[model samples]
Target: MIAIAIKNLSYHYPDRTPALLDINLQVKRGLKTAILGMNGSGKTTLLYHLNGVIPVESGEVQVFGTPVVKERITEVRRMVGLLFDNPDNQLFSTTLRNDIAFGPRNLRLEPALVHRKVEEAMQLLSIEDLADRPPYCLSLGQKKRAAIAGLISMEPQVLVFDEPFSGLDPALGRQFRELLDELVSGGCTLVYSTHDVDLAYAWADEVVLMHSGRVLKSGPVDLLCDEKTMMRANLPVPLLGRLFQGWNEKPRTLEEALNLMGSTGLAKGKRLQA
Candidate 1:
């Protein structure tokens, strides 16, 4: 199933500055897809159109085969849950529990179901201990998880994140990757935008590179390994990609990379201890 489809999509702000130009994309169901671009390259603008957060100005966007029009906007939003780059923009409830519960409750779910969803989302994100805390008082990383919990609580089929790991430390970033793995295992389609070429290279099944409000390229993760494409997109080749170039094999995680390096004696050196 195609989770999202876009054709000739273009958008501009009220001031007439173009944000997206002739963008075309199709995201498949249950894949971890990443949109890679430099800042102001239309990554967020394209994401906003996915969930109907911003109206489609000159073309069409369809979520699960339904056109994103006024009559179907509600349905589109229900199917696509978007997480902003800033957690503060999405979180507004007094308590963590309330914030996570907001989405399910707004869906008019049964009270018991809403409660269950809130609990489940918190547990999934390991934020149960933060249930009583106010979002305003939480750290940047905590608030990011809380915002994600709120979206997952709604049980949307597709989750869209704009710079989801911007404020996380290395440890939290690893945990976030684990959370995404669990989400994909549970059949959620994950679409995210990132300026981190390393993360995009390692995590995405498919990648889309945008430049100047247009898509420069879109294909499998191998697209990132293309020197010309990465240079054209102004993205550097990821460390692993550079290291493994022409090797016909790539490790997907740090542990895998370390293990591979160890087995191949790539980590050994004349000055290093055996």
Candidate 2:
């Protein structure tokens, strides 16, 4: 089933600056898709249409076959949860617990049900201990987890994230990826935008390369293996592809690269002595 369909999409800023132009794309349900581009490439503008965050000015955006129009905007938002780049923008409650509970409470669920939902989301994001603290008092990573917990409480079928990992150290980033994996495992479709080629190559099921308000290409992760296309997009080839450029087998992930190295005896005598 198709989770998202965007056709003939175009957008312009109020000042007459073009943001997106003639975009046509489709994402399958339960797949992880990465929008790849440099800054100002219209990736974020296109994502905002998924949940009607930005009104469709010139084209159509469908979420799971439902049109994202003002008449059904609430339904679209219910089906698609968007995570802003800044957790502060998503969180506006006094305490972390309140922030996490906001979504369910707004849905008018029974109080007990809302509590259960909040509890489950907190546990899922491992943010239970930070519940009573104020959002402003928590670290950036903690605030991110709290914001995500709130979204998880909504149980949206599709999660739209704009630069979800913009400011995290390596450990926190891995934790976030693990959380995303858990969501995908539970049948949620994931669509996120990122400028990091390595992250997109290693994590996404597919890649949509955008440039100058247009889609350069959209296909399997292997599409990133083409150095020429990466260059044309003005983005670097994924680090993995660069590291193994001439090899017949190009591995996209670290494990795959290690396996390739083992198979080719590249690591035979390179082990560091203890």
Candidate 3:
């Protein structure tokens, strides 16, 4: 089912240079979608519109079938959780554990429920080790995971992540990807924006390429993240992407790549091929 919908959406800054124009999009439950764009491409601006942080100058946005208006804005925002790139912006509690529990506590869930939720979220994000640490003391990666844990505690149906990988180390990027996969399995819808074509291609079921505040293309990752499409989007498919370009096989996940290579027998038996 469609958890979020945006139709004919457009936005403009106070400077009024146009942030988005005629944007139509839908996010289904339990699906992972990547919104890819370079700087000044309106990725974050559009994300703001999704959760109703920025009112649309023209268009309609509905979250979980809740039409966004002043009266219903809080409802919409509650239904859609947002994890900004910087965890500092989202994590407000004195400690990681408190930050994780803060959301459910605000919702008035039972104390037991709140504790369970926080523990589950922290464990799921694999940051149980950092649960008691101060939010400001965490490394960039741990802070990001804590931010995600905070969002998870809220248990929103749809999540909008803005540049979750920015400033993250390579290992952290992969760890975040695993968390995203787990979130999708748990039936949380995701729409994350990033400038990295490679990670977007690896993790996203659908890639939406935006440029000049317009959607240049939207399609399967393999189709839109190809060489030609990358060139059109002014991005590059990673070295692995270059290796797997075309040839009838689609490698969506890391495991799929290894399986494909082994299944296709990329290396022949030359006596030393054990």
Candidate 4:
């Protein structure tokens, strides 16, 4: 099943500045997909259309076979959860606990059910300690966690995140990644945008490369190995890609690269000690 389908999608800012042009893409159900691009590449603008955050000005966007239009926007939003790059845009409640409980409450679920969802989300995000604190008093990372907790409490089927790693420390980043894995394992579809080629290369099952509001290329993770395409998109080759530049085989993760390098003695000086 296709989780998202976008065709001939185009958008322009209020000032008439083109933000997206003739985009055509599809994300498979339950797969991890990345929108890879440089800054000002229209990554965020394209994401907004997935959940009807930005109404389609031209062409169409469909989430799980439902067209993103006013008539079906509620249904679309219910299925797809979007996490903004800046937490401030999503976290508006006076208290962190209330912010996390906002979505579940909006659904009009029983108060007990809403409370349970809030507690689960807070525990998953490790922000239970900040429950009573005002959002303004927390650090940027804490705010990001709170925002994520709020979204998770909704339990949307498709998760769309814009630069999800922006404010997370290493430990928090790893924790969030594990949570994403758990969600996907439970049959959720994941889509995220990022300018980090290395992260996309190592993490995404597929990627759509964008440049100047246009899709330069879209394909399996192997597409990142295309030096010409990466150059055209103004993105450097991923670290692993550069290391395996001329090799017949390219490994996606560090552990795989290390194994291959050890077996082939590709490392210049002594092979990585076991």
Structural similarity to truth (TM-score) of each candidate: 0.94, 0.94, 0.88, 0.95
> Per-residue lDDT of 1-274 in model 3, one digit per residue for the tens?
9887889988888997888989988877788889987788889988888777788688898887888767787788778888886778888778899999988988889999999999998888789998888899988888988998888889888889999888777886777778778778988888999877767777788778888898877876775546676677777776567777765886766788877877777634332576
What are the per-residue Cα lDDT tens digits for candidate 1 across 170-190? 887888789888888888999
Candidate 2 — what's its lDDT? 0.90
Q: Give the candidate number with the greatest lDDT.
A: 4
Candidate 2 C-alpha lDDT tens digits along 1-274:
8999999999998898999999999998898999999889998889888988889989899998999999999899999999987899888889999998999998899999999999999997788899999999988878888888899899999999988888776887898799889889888999999988899999999999999999999999989988888888999888898899888888888999999888887776577442
TM-score, cand. 2 vs. native: 0.94
Reference-based TM-score, model 3: 0.88
From the highest TM-score down, the ranking of the candidates is 4, 2, 1, 3
Q: Which stretches of candidate 1 lie over 4 Å from their true place?
A: 268-274
| Model 3 CA RMSD to the hidden true structure, in angstroms | 2.6
Give the TM-score comparing model 1 with the true structure, all chains together.
Answer: 0.94
Residue pairs with colliding backbones in model 2 are none
* Candidate 2 wrongly placed segments (more than 4 Å): 271-274
Worst 10 residues of 3 by lDDT: 265-274
Where does candidate 4 clash, by residue pair? none
- Which stretches of candidate 4 lie above 4 Å from their native place? 265-274
| Cα-based lDDT for every prediction | 0.90, 0.90, 0.82, 0.92
